[model samples]
Target: AAQTDAWDGVRALRADYRTATGERREVVLGDGTVLSLNTGSAVNVRFDASRRLVELLAGEILVISGHGAGSGVPLEVATREGRVRALGTRFAVRQQDEYSTVDVFESAVEIRPRDGSGAPLLLAAGRGAAFCRHASGAPHAVGAYADAWSRGQLIVDDVTLGDFLAELARYRPGVIDCAPAVARLRLSGVFPLADTQRILNMLPNSLPVQVRSRTRYWVSVEPAS
Candidate 1:
């Protein structure tokens, strides 16, 4: 991507705060908005007295827009897929290889795809949009993502056990994998804020699986006896 107009600090191309290929960081913007960047993320900052823009290069970001930023000056987060103009909204964006997931927790946002979708997608609170890189998406419901972020819980609604575990591994750092024996197990319910332990402990009782903890950070799930 070519650089934007004259960047900060006399640099041709400027990124407000950038991380390497495998680094994660937390950035606090001048306007009081906080961005929690997942691994391999880069963001260009455009914060002034009037407008606020965050251009994400890669990875995931958890955003909490500050209160009372102004009346008409909305906050925006842009990525390779499109731009998100937040109307006093709190949302998160995850840009991966295949698609980008936009989860809205509060207020509303306008999602504009660069592929020339004249009608931008409007997502309200507790809604989400998944933009497929290869093709257009059906715009299904992802209320779980939005609700979970707000309540600080992980609600897996009838998802495959493998898929459930795969998601649980993201919040925490380490290698936590599921065995094939429990791959087909179906799961539901909520995992409270930062409480992977509680979820792991209850899995065996709720489903036909055996959850064995190798360590506090490492766990494995298999078919029950």
Candidate 2:
């Protein structure tokens, strides 16, 4: 956690995350693959005229298949939760706190929990899952988080405000405190990065809590009356 290099290998690099401002960077693996990293995210490359590998830290990222690599050429991601294997597809891997999510946009990926276990969990398109860091375990869904990054949209059914806020905070950096009184409230809407401020402004209209900004770098939810 002290001063150190956040990146490794020439194909991958880590953007600066020191200024409390989310940072993003791009990398082109030796195989002509393009990668777009998100805020507070970092990656390591594993390519040397043989295989292709990438590792992700926090935030979101988009991976496009690169050519000049053989069919079934391994495109793997290492994270705090475990290892993810891509299968001729586009995918995004996120590691936030104790939670790690893999959303496959195309094809499938095999997840081998960093538990050092030999077997792995297979994830197909349109389905996503979460892993618990302590136990090297994860849940299965039919790719629910599939389009979280590529599509830039979310489809939530009936869920508590607390759950929704917890999910929304993944995209934004820093703190987003929600009051207990309004955490149970339920609502649904679409929020894009371009309209994040609008989303912040709209929250107070429905709940009794006000969304106050602290220097625009942090936010807190508090009782309105």
Query: Which model scores highest in lDDT?
Result: 1
Clashes of each: 0, 5
Distance from true location, Cα of 34 in model 1, Å: 5.2
- State the displacement of the C-alpha of residue 178, model 2, in Å, after optimal TM-score superposition: 1.0
Model 1 Cα shift for residue 140 (angstroms): 2.7
TM accuracy, model 1: 0.68
Q: TM per model?
A: 0.68, 0.74
Q: Taking the tens digit of each residue's C-alpha lDDT, what string does model 2 give over 9-57?
A: 1223333321112344566666767777765566666666556777664
Q: What is the per-residue lDDT of model 1 for residues 174-219, given as tens digits with 9 covering 90 to 100?
A: 6667888779778788787456677778887788888777886677
C-alpha-based local distance difference test score of model 2: 0.66
**Would you list the clashing residue pairs of candidate 2?**
126-142, 126-143, 127-142, 127-143, 128-143
Worst 10 residues of 2 by lDDT: 1-10
